[model samples]
Target: MPTTTRSESTQAALLEAARDVFAEKGYVNAKIADITGRAGRSIGSFYNYYDTKQQLLRALLERFPAQIVERARDGLSDDWAANIEAAVRAYFHTFRDYLPEMIGVFQLSMSDPDAAAWWRSQRAYGIASVLALIDAVEQDGDRIGLDHHVFASAIVSMLESYCWTWLAAGGDDVDAVFDEETAIHTLAAMWRRAMVGES
Candidate 1:
């Protein structure tokens, strides 16, 4: 039915709009009416799809990484730096794409249970990717107990934080150049430091 198809489309739009809203506003204080407004849908129609903001947010949270994972896999290869670069590009692109709507997900996660769970899930996936890169880069009989994962996490953490700051800063193309230079130099340093033997 056309009505059913339209209903599905409206629900998809709201879910996407809610993802942006939650990412920007965070989960604790974001309102359903605000999400509905962003989706250009009636309040009642919004309810027809999701009973609450958290429900829609969870759906979005799930969908977001699924999309990213598909992208990550598409760009995946045995080459670690390429994979890493592709992954980072995918992440930032997603972040940039969702920048306007993610306000809710950002502002209110510290206290919300659903958000906490979703974040744990997201963080775990990130940690896995970091570990994969570490495994790729580390040679056998390398330094043991170096806490490479922690090291990798700290590196990616800085990258993610910097990305958010860059997006928030509203800067020019010069800022992008700075980011590119800094990331390449910093990551090269990380690789150098991570080396345990001539390889």
Candidate 2:
């Protein structure tokens, strides 16, 4: 049990280090040696843990979405639209919580095919949730709205755009820009416009 705990701890550290290096240098330019150096381990030691850099990179790309979903689940369990809004907010807030890691992920997504795939999956999940929200809004079947999928796509695009801007802002304190209140305001505004056709 103790050995497993130690392995888990070290794996987390290595994952963090890989994220940093991958972000700064990208997959093509990032070296296994650099990752190992950042993790304070030798090449052989890194091999002992991960089979390859691509696998590690895949793991790094996947870590945050799962975390965001978990946090959303914890914080959002009420109404569906409200939960979606809360989930979006929670994701951005969590992104800010790990800004440096996020920057790396963004950078990787730009140049690495694997990273791009991971990013696409992330966006797809958000878009799917927004579509679900649209369904809930139309549960009455009045068709009393614009095409929910269209609106959902637009909203998801808007959100990802904002997040990309935040990631690139390079401010000393990025998290301050995305507090709970900011999320509530932006998400609520968009959702209200979509569901009620006010905007």
Candidate 3:
């Protein structure tokens, strides 16, 4: 592998530090000082990479979908059940891996219009993927029996909310923390059932 340059290394450090800080303190409450401190770099160095915390957070968020796609690619299959399971598993792992970005984007989106728009764009991407899957299923003579657009939207919403609730928000019941495989299987089964009526 090609070696990373000094600038690239510095930026990587900053991003990693930002992720940790965001996870611990959240986007709104996290400070530049904290990130810099965690990164073991001066505050000035952070600006050399990103203009603001929002920019850093955006960078992280941009990686989320691509990571999921990459992980899910190998698991994708012609079977609808396998496809849903693969997608759900990929999303669950990616969400866990990028929990900090998930938390940051969600918190920032609540107050910033640009952030909110970005969040919606992310959801739109998922919705489009779902619609494509729906089309494929229909072409295979499998009737969905629901409005394609609405079904796509609802599926995306369900995946997003469920991941956020369990992973980021810790769910409602403190005693109910789920194992990774169980969570992924549960989501995959639910999604598969929604699409084809049997998990």
Number of the top candidate by TM-score? 3
Candidate 1, residue 101: the lDDT equals 38
- Candidate 2, backbone clash total: 0
Show model 1 residue runs off by greater than 4 Å.
1-4, 16-30, 38-40, 139-145, 169-199
lDDT of each: 0.64, 0.69, 0.86
Q: Quote the lDDT for 100 in model 1.
A: 47
Arranged by TM-score, best first: 3, 2, 1
Pairs that clash in candidate 2:
none
Model 3 TM-score (2 dp): 0.92
Candidate 1 local lDDT, residue 82: 64
RMSD of 3: 1.8
Arrange candidates by lDDT, descending.
3, 2, 1
Clashes of 1: 19
Candidate with the greatest lDDT versus the true structure: 3
lDDT of 1 by residue, 1-199 (tens): 3456887889888986776666566556568887789899988998787777666766665655556567778888876656665676666666666664344455446567777676666766667766766676665334535686686667557655665667744545673455654554454445445543222
Model 1 weakest 10-residue run by lDDT: 190-199
